[model samples]
Target: MRDVLVIGGGIIGLLTARELRLSGAEVTLIEMGQTGRESSWAGGGIISPLYPWRAPEPITALSRWSQTVYPALTTQLLDETGIDPEFTINGMLVLDDEDLDQALDWGARHGQPIEILQEPAPHAIEPELGPRPARALLLPGIAQLRPPRLSKAVRRALEKRIDLREREEVCELLVADGRVCGVRTPKGQVEAKRVVICAGAWTAKLLEQLGTPPDIQPVRGQMLLFHAKPGQINHITLHAGRYAIPRRDGRVLFGSTLEHAGFVKRTTAEDKEALYNDAIELFPVLRRTPIEDHWSGLRPGSPSGIPYIGAYPGIEGLYFNAGHFRNGLVMGPASARLMVDLMLDREPILNPAPYALNASR
Candidate 1:
């Protein structure tokens, strides 16, 4: 029997296979489509877990821990596979004073070098933003990664021996004699000793087949990207209104409207216009840039805005690591680590209390 069967090809599933394989376990990863094309690939790729006022503690902790591993991790992947995740620190800026205060407090408490700047700091693409006001908090270490690149590298690294089964859609968790023994897929039955469901927005649907979907639904997000003035905005600047995330390359990812509509992955004209209007306001020079593309992804959102990790209460050997919402790209590595540690050996880096599947109970 394979030591582990990861039933999704997103960041968490790929990372879990990596972690478990590091522990010398035979792992196989299954994906219904090309790897990392889901919400994991569709995110803005923000690295900082620090929200302005409120953020979940367990998830935030995991993000911080993952940030430490990213440097060595991405570099090693690049060296081995010649695929750069494009990990770069572009700094995150806060515009609102109220939000900035919350950021300062939390950052100081957590050893984050969130700087409070009085004067406008030197930034790339200053002309596009068109004379923004001063008062900004700069998180020097916060950054971004190319999600598609990381996903490709991880797939390449794991596909050799991890039994990567793409285009294999998992239909149900096969429970026999009160234990998760395998999974039912469209192609055939995958027999395994254990199963890990990492099915992002589709997690609830899969779990419902097992009779325990944990109140997770699709929170649709609309995003727009532009090949704007090269180096117009270098830092990740955020306000209560919108966010502008600039990559090491010339592209600027402006985005993401949080809507509670269920399972709608289609883009809308209004959301597109809204993003552009907000982007130009943040940096006015964007008026000249062509709208490169627009897209949407359905993030798995829970009521409390937290992901459920660890084992399912009723099913033995059944595990869930879904419902990450917006933090998937930022915080998936550490969460996957915690999951592997807990499920493989029943020991985790931090107390897994808050993120327990039954935490609300």
Candidate 2:
């Protein structure tokens, strides 16, 4: 029996399994499909929440901690696995002025430096921006990573250290004497001392029979990728819930629409056209550039966009670390660390009460 059985291979699960292994626990990670091919691979990889001030404090805390440690974590991953996640601090420019006051106040309270740029200033920061807003907020410390690359890097690092089971779906939890003993997969039952559910959008379904499961549902988001020249857009540009992320290699990721489509991961032409129009409105250069790819992923949406991360009620040795919504990539590391800490009985990095499964109850 392994010390831990992670029931998903997304970013959260990969990171959690890695953390558990680092803490000297034998870990086995099983995925329904190929690892990192779901939401983790499809996200824009923004290291911070879209609007830090607008999110709940728990999300802020997790993102803040994750942002701080990202550099070190990526560096270590590069050193060990020879893959660069391309963690870049290119900053983020908010073109919407509706939340300026709240944003400033939240920045002040959180000690995050935010600059209000006016006129040519916003244009000066991002020359590719078209029809700029009168005022904009600049989060200079914001960063982004290539999600596919990061996922690959983390998987590469974990492949050698932990038992990674790809293409194996965990259909049911095996319980004995009122305790979770293992899980049932298509192949066979694998026993474990503890089980952690990091199944992303599928988390709630897995826990439905257990009890009052976390309010997690699949929120579908479709994105379009544009191939542009390097340095065309210097920062992440956001307006009206849509954003453009410029990668290190001249590829810009323009996304996304939050649709309650219920586990449907198919991309649509209508959404692609809408997203293209929005992207061009933000960065006019994209009008001429070709869209390299279009895809969709289902985010694990929860109430208030807060993820549930703690032990399961009435089920010993069962735990949860899912429901991150759109911020899973940003909150992955800290969420994993916190889950591991609670599981191993170590001092957690932040208050675990807010993320507990019973917090809402």
Candidate 3:
């Protein structure tokens, strides 16, 4: 029997397989589609949450830990695989006044350098912004990475070390007598001592067959890409609730809309027009730019806005590291470390109690 079977092929599953293999566990990762092409590849690559001060402590902790280690990890990956994920610290600009005082207090308590700006200062930083948002917060510690490149790097890094089974959808868990022994795919059965569901948006559906359904649902987010000059936008800009992320290759990513659209990954013209309008409103220079591409992905959303990252309650040998929602890219690396620590019975790098399976429920 295999030592472990990872059920998803997004960033979480790919990294989990790497960690387990490094720990000397025979690992096999199964994916329904192409590896790393799910929500992991479709995100805007913001390493920090939008107004992170409003997030829960567990979410904040995971994101902060990821920020601490991502630079070194990306550097190592680039050295090894010749693929630069472009992890950059261009910072984030939040142009909203709601909960301004609370966010300031949270930043102070957490020791994150934050500058609260009144009227004209917001316009001075990004002179192209609309006149709606009169206030802003500049968070210099925020960072971003090109998600597609990071995904490619991880897949390349695990090329020889992991048995990557793409185009294989896990239909059910082979659980019996208080423990899960394997998984059932369309082709055949995969036997393993441990099983991890890192399937992103499809996780809750997979677990439902085993009678312990997690409160995870699919949230579809649509994004638009626009080609622009190199110096079109200086920083990752956020106003109201949408954002525009400029890439090093002069591609500005205007994102995203959260909809409960049940595993549907279709990009609509309505959302595209809405995003374009918002993006143009955020930066007037974008009015002349043409949209190059548009796409959508389903993020795994949980009721508590946190992932279930522990042994499934009462299900031996069955674990979960899914339901990270939109923060999967930021949280995946550290979460993989934590999950491997738990699976191998080692001391966790961070407190794992807050993200335990039952904790969220």
- The candidate maximizing lDDT is 2
Q: Model 3: runs farther than 4 Å from truth? A: none
lDDT of 3 by residue, 65-180 (tens): 88899999999999989999999888899887788888889888888898887888877777767776667889988889999899999999988887889998887789899899
The residue-by-residue lDDT of candidate 1 on 1-361, one tens digit each, is: 7878888899988988888788888887888987899888888888865363477776678777888888888998999899999999888877766766677788888888877776545343243445555666778888789888998888878878688898989887889778988887878788877788888888888888766677778888888888865577777888765778887778888888999777768899998998888888777767888889899888888765678778887778888888887888777888888888888775788777877767872
Q: Between candidates 2 and 3, which one is better according to lDDT?
A: 2
Q: Is candidate 1 or candidate 2 better by TM-score?
A: 2
How far residue 177's Cα lies from its native spot in candidate 2, in Å, is 1.3
For model 2, how does the per-residue alpha-carbon lDDT over 18-97 read when each residue is reduced to its tens digit? 89999999999999999999999989999999878989999999999999899999999999999999999999999988
TM-score, candidate number 2? 0.98
For TM-score, candidate 1 versus 3, the one ahead is 3
lDDT of 1 at 156: 79
Off by over 4 Å in 1: 50-53, 120-127, 131-133
* lDDT (C-alpha, whole model) for all candidates: 0.80, 0.92, 0.88
Clashing pairs in 2: none
Q: What are the models' TM-scores?
A: 0.95, 0.98, 0.97
For candidate 1, which ten residues in a row score worst on lDDT?
120-129
Which residue pairs in candidate 1 have backbone atoms (N, alpha carbon, C) closer than 3 angstroms, thus clashing? Answer: 124-232, 125-232, 128-283, 128-284, 128-285, 129-283, 129-284
| Candidates by TM-score, descending order | 2, 3, 1
Better of 2 and 3 by TM-score: 2
- Which candidate ranks first by TM-score, i.e. highest? 2
Q: Given candidate 2, what's the lDDT at residue 121?
A: 93
